[model samples]
Target chain A: MMVRMAATRDGYGDALLELGGNQRVVVLEADLGKSTKSLHFRKQFPQRTISCGIGEQNMFLVGAGLAASGYIPFASTFAIFTERGFEQMRNGIARPNLAVHVCGSHGGTHTGTDGSSAQSIEDLAIYRTLPNVTVLHPCDDVSTKILTKQLVHLNSPSYTRTARNKSPVLYDGREDEIEIGKGVIHRDGNDAAIIACGILVSEALQAAQELSLEGIEVTVIDMHTIKPLDEALVLDVAKKCGKIVTAEDHSIIGGLGGAVSEYLIENYPVPMKRIGVADRFGESGESEEMLNLLGLSAPFIAEAVRKLLNS
Target chain B: MSSIAELEEVARKCRVRIVDMVYNAQAGHPGGSLSEIDILVALYGTTLRVDPKNPSWEDRDRFILSKGHASPGMYAILAEHGFIQEHDLTSYRVLGGKCQGHVDAKWCPGVDFSAGSLGMGLSFGMGSALAARLDGSQRQAYVMLGDGEIQEGSVWEAAMAAVHHELGNLNVILDCNGIQNDDFCDEQMRMFDIPKKWEAFGWNVKIIDGHNMSEILEGLEFLKNSNQKPNILIARTVKGKGVSYMENNPSFHGAAPNDEQYALAMKELGVA
Candidate 1:
């Protein structure tokens, strides 16, 4: 076991560069190309890149227009700033079922020192509510690259959330194994299962490893696609493990934890603990400090699993 | 090409159809529809290079009704141009019907984009124009925006982007009908000196009488001949132009005329 760390934004930039070879693939940005890493695509194909000049709503509508005219447009902005264009994305892109890829970078508290204004703790929830929108939060660089490429072939609108901080790469470039609406079972254990997305997948894996030493075998699953969730896997895990612990780098209200809990409560009726940000906003801090302060670190997740087991 | 008189006759028929659909549906924006019908007739009859038999023709010029609340006008034009059957106009706003309350490209043929939310049509038009430019296609993109819809911040965003991209194939027709949903635009948001505002945004601006067939054709010709910059034709129009009682009346902005008013409107348009 060798470990490699890379920001999910890097994966997005690299994947965009590769996708830029296709003339139909255009990239639109809202004046945050450098931070969102869409500048890589701009550098490669300047003609194909559209700078929307700090207008997220216009960027969304423009992307919809391009999609309507037989072009696949990837519209990128800060995850928090995507709220400015939510209505445009809903009405223009999702409502029409256009093939536009909305990439929201710096998702969640992992955005670190940029503070609450930059962090998007509710982007997935907002996008999930829109009909015909595929909401995805890739776990690490590898998954992000895989999913970003997959978005090119998808004919419906999709939202992909990437993190600003570098997380441990969980895959070895075996992208063929990843599917959009399917969950990847990283570690299988019988005691309890931990389902997480975005940067929390690595945290959940670390928690599973730490809990394994104490004779508590916990299964860790990467539930990346929030909308069109992998129900069969979740139900199988719930029926097998009996207890479920969900973790994410977002709010506990309507993120991965909320989606998982809502599904299990209805279908399986299992006892579960959701580990995420409670109703409070995040502040500027180092990435590791923010994760620890927000109780999203591996220890916090393991503690949550232990509590669920004991109860 | 249709003569000015012939175009006016078509516009008159479309105006009749607009009032009829709105009145039958029991809910619709007839004022803007009536104001914009003549402009649509001018475009559909002469300017646009579209095949009604092949609504999705790849090389066809794209028309987006950005002021989407005026769907009755667009639907009438689509029906007249043979893109959609005339009987479909009777099902305006009916559940699971082709004629939706707003212009839905999915349900309506010859509609280039879906628009109801204001200020988005310009952006979509710019995008289509940019796409055509990239593909080296001769087709152009035309977007019809409401006078009040320009107040939306997103419209300016698209305007600026269109100029920045230097989208020469993009044409925006602003139906400056004076009134919005509640009151006169000047009384509501005070969108004064709109032509100068567009000129300042780096677009080639043209002011035209929207209801006059000759002025409408001249503006279209100017746009078609011009190159290097995006063009915007600010067509000054009377709200509910053909219908005498609803003319310049803000009350008819989103209200379908009652039976008495509908009959009077039909008589005024000579379709009674």
Candidate 2:
């Protein structure tokens, strides 16, 4: 099947432009609007868009302030830069349970050539620790758009990680399959489940396809929502497959893999191998190079699956 | 709408509650609360347009206490204005208490911003002001900051953004109490030319005695009359204004008054 390619950041921007129709929906940017794809909304709805200007800490609280005053505010910056405002996110946004949607684009080591400083290896881990904050890392442009729009009805704070790099458009015509807290399974099998998120979702699908050719059937789950994790689905797969290989372009400490493992260990234990960055920073390179170097590409995911099954 | 004398009397009672709340709770910040009581009393008692019954009413003026450890003052004033019962003050710093050790909007009524970490309320206030403008509401945001709280770089980020956005409806009251938890502001960080610093940030600066009810009212007037830019009233204050032994004492910045000290405070405030 032929696949289209699109960046998740574009989907974030598309969602903002569509949400602009609601008078209560407002956009905030801290001088990285173009990078985070909020410039699209800023240009069209300059009046409702607030330009916070080179201040991420101020941007989060400003978003919170807007949330408190009956406005749905969406703020964005690079993933690594968003960490600069994590305390603000914790105290102002999450503590108050304000409905501020924060999009941290260019997340993970898959963001090309920006080097270690720009690549956010633990954005997911930090945000997951926050109480009353939903954490999301949608796989494709369509899913990003769908999940972001769902935030309008949530009436709570959320942190979404989007990528600057383009990936295979998985949910192009299957928009209805996408939900905020539920995982989307691309290919299903009983051998083992490959639970992944962000850019690794596509890699997990590719690995599952490759494994199928070799008679090792596998389940491919796009575990997009990291917090308020889909424990029901995770437990179902752990029961069916008996073995699991979790993958992501984030740190293994507390990203997608950490969330899944923590849930399974507590509820139902299973033999699992988390395929992710080994708590190391990325160097200046193409996303493909970084993914391969960090053991997060399709082949690496397949190898991990085989290793898990063998174990 | 209260006269200056009526506001002063109300503030004196709040001062009694500020120390009493700390003493009953066995732990709370009384020093900064005593210094900020007069301003909180004047703002909520007379000028701020808020309904205690409808605390979440849209278009109500948003008040953010950035220096939230000084929450005793806010809780006392909130009780005086009926946001909560006077009995709720007993829950200060206690678990399951609406009066959290810090100012939190989720726990308490009429609190617009949940502030505990310093240098945050101004930015939140700016957001509130912007939201009001977008909704075409005439409500303003009042943020109270401490002298030491401005030491955080994020505060400067908000100060710059408020000026850049020309947020005329954003008002700030800095409790220039000179002392922080560890020591005085001069010892911790010399913020020389404090008013000049705000003026440099393009804000309309006003200085007043934060303890004086009439001066605090005048400062509120200055905030109301000023427009087209952010405003800040750099109110000079003592860390522990009402209690003699605690006055200008850094140790009292975050400490609860002992039983003896509490009695002394009540006697000094003429509530004995």
Candidate 3:
């Protein structure tokens, strides 16, 4: 398998430049164009891009207005800064059911040295609670770009979180594999399924490969859309594997783990373990170091899977 | 409704409806509603280029009540402009009612914004203005804000952005009614030299007595003629302008007028 590495933010920028072809697609930036990779689109379409300065709250509503006016507006900022305009997104956009695509770049503890403040471990959780709001956390650049382009056809609002660090391009040439709400099976097995999202998808792949070498064949799923959880896929994996391990770079509570558990408990209860940041804040550190410290690396995922299998 | 007398009569009728809706519902902010009715009446009657038959007309000027709690004023004027019937005013705050407690575009007619929160409409208006500019249309986006509502930090963010974007198509109506939900604007928070603040932000500011129909028309004319920068009409008004007892009274800001007081308010506005 040819492995190419790229940041999901770069994919977001690339997708924006592509979406610029559509006359109605406009980009909004809250002074994070460079960081969120929206600068690429801004450079090409300055008239269509709205520079909102350092006002995330204002940027969100501006996007809502554009959406209301029949224009598809995409706004981007840091993951944590997006939270600053959460209410605006909820009231002005989601309640009105405006199709404003908001991309919160540099999500999760994997965002590294910008520290706990910049690393938004709760964006997915908070956004998932909003009605008519779609939440996404794609694993790699290819997947991110594919999901973002699909937002143009959607008449509802969405919150897509991207990362600052690069991950293995799992869908390098498999552009047909990614969809907004469906999970993609990276590695297939029936022993115990490892469902992960965002940066943790690569880690889950590594974990599955390690377990396969030991003849303990494992399943790896990239559950990108957290809000609209692919219930059929989850139920399928749950029924086949009979055991599940949910992984994410977000908090263990109200994230991918929380979402899966909530659904499985009422519909299909199975033995499960959620691998994530134990309800705690992150600190400034290297990407690999942060994952290792938070016990979110491949070794930790493999360890959890092993423990679940033994139990 | 082009003449001042005709517009004043419209304002008076809307005033009756404003009080009637809040009084009948036994809920809502009647003070700000009464304060803002004159401006709303003027805009819908003489200033705004809108087609009541096509409320969602693509080229129509956008009207956003950023201080959305004062929906009665908006609803009343909307009724006067034939956007909604006076019969629809009966649904104020009712279940499955089009007239939501807060103004909502999705639920109601002639409402461009589905608003409940404060300091949000300006940005939305700015967006609408930008969209108008992008489309090369001559349509304008109008937002109404309360004196107390300016305290929200996000409003400043948008105020700066609107000026920076040079949104000449965006117009703001500041209903300086001097009162908030809790108390007067001075008591709650002193928004010192409000005109200077807007002027400092590089906006085109015009001052007027909000309840004066002729002055409001002049202000509207000024906003319409402005180019190269956004404009704000600072309309100094009395909270509960039509109701004698509720006038300048903090208690009436969020409270409903009693039946007796409602009758008095109706009588004060010369409503049969």
Q: Which candidate has the top score in DockQ?
A: 2
Off by over 4 Å in 3: none
Candidate 3: chain B TM-score against the reference chain B: 0.98
For model 2, how big is the CA root-mean-square deviation? 1.1
* Candidate 1 Cα lDDT to native: 0.91
Least lDDT summed over 10 consecutive residues: which range in candidate 1 chain A? A170-179
Model 2 agreement with the true structure over B1-272: per-residue lDDT tens digits: 88988989998899888888889888878889988888999999878999999999998998999999999999989999899999999999889999999988879997777778988999999999998888888889999999999999999999999999989999999999999989998998998999999999999999999988888989999999657899999999998988999899988988887778878888999983
lDDT tens per residue, model 3, A122-172: 999999999999999999999999999999998999999999999888888
In model 2, which runs have C-alpha deviations exceeding 4 angstroms?
A: none
For model 1 chain B, where is the 10-residue window of minimal lDDT?
B263-272
DockQ of each: 0.86, 0.92, 0.88
lDDT accuracy of residue B148 in candidate 3: 93
lDDT of 2 at A184: 84
- Mark the 10 consecutive residues where model 3 chain B has the least summed lDDT: B257-266
Q: lDDT values of the candidates? A: 0.91, 0.91, 0.93
Q: How close is candidate 3 to the true structure, as a TM-score?
A: 0.99
Q: Any idea what lDDT model 2 has?
A: 0.91
**Candidate 1 vs candidate 3, DockQ winner:** 3
